[model samples]
Target: MIAAAWLFGVGGAILVGIGGFFRLARPALLPEDLRYLRRTPDEIDAAVPSLRGWLRLVFIVLGGYAVATGTLTIYLAATDIRNAESSAVAVLAVTGASSIGVMALVNFALHSTFRWPLSAAAALWIVATLMAVVS
Candidate 1:
């Protein structure tokens, strides 16, 4: 159980960290499907020049938050697993699952190209959460 938790937690953290880094430091390096630069023609026409600046800031802030959240998940799971605290483990499991689930839902609703990857991650998290609960 501990091993599984660690695997899931660390994997999630790494994936999120990479995404955040790219979004913040080299957005152009991100894959076209994953990039936030895909604005519709109407959206582009309606957007002010300053909107790009605001969007960049928003992406940076949101990316940082995502990275922090992923890091917290890893830390919480590791600490709780190390302490052999089932209750703490359960809490982290539920929290991690819900967080990822929300992200998946948001991506789906937005019709984001990243939706499939987010959905897969969310599914894995949910399974890990369930296993933690039952184990």
Candidate 2:
């Protein structure tokens, strides 16, 4: 149970750390994501300056969502999940699928630099879930 909790907490922390970086970083867009779009920042500005603001907004919201997800996972692991029953797993499963799972999927599809790390994060989450079940 302790291992399960620790694993879950670490997985959640990954999300929180990455999300916070995205939210706080000056670049707004991940360098890889910008590279994927085939536009340097200056090139983007040259093409459509307004686009940068929109991208910033998008990343800000996405980053906030990631942080919220991590926080929720940590809270559940710390407070309820240890003693939880089937319903707890259900909640966590659904939450992960909708957030981290989806993020990983999109990153993979785009061949983004985030893909492998996000996939590893998702794996941590998956292993943590399995540990919870067995523990």
TM of each candidate vs. truth: 0.73, 0.84
lDDT of 1 by residue, 1-135 (tens): 776577568646855774577466744222443345576544554765565567677677777767777777777677776666787667766666566677678777667776897788777776766666667
lDDT of each: 0.66, 0.79
What is the model-wide C-alpha lDDT for candidate 1?
Answer: 0.66
Off by over 4 Å in 1: 22-47
Per-residue lDDT over 26-60 for candidate 2, one digit per residue giving the tens place of the 0 to 100 score: 36556776768888888878888788788778778
TM-score of 1: 0.73
**Each candidate: RMSD:** 4.0, 2.0
Top of the candidates by TM-score: 2
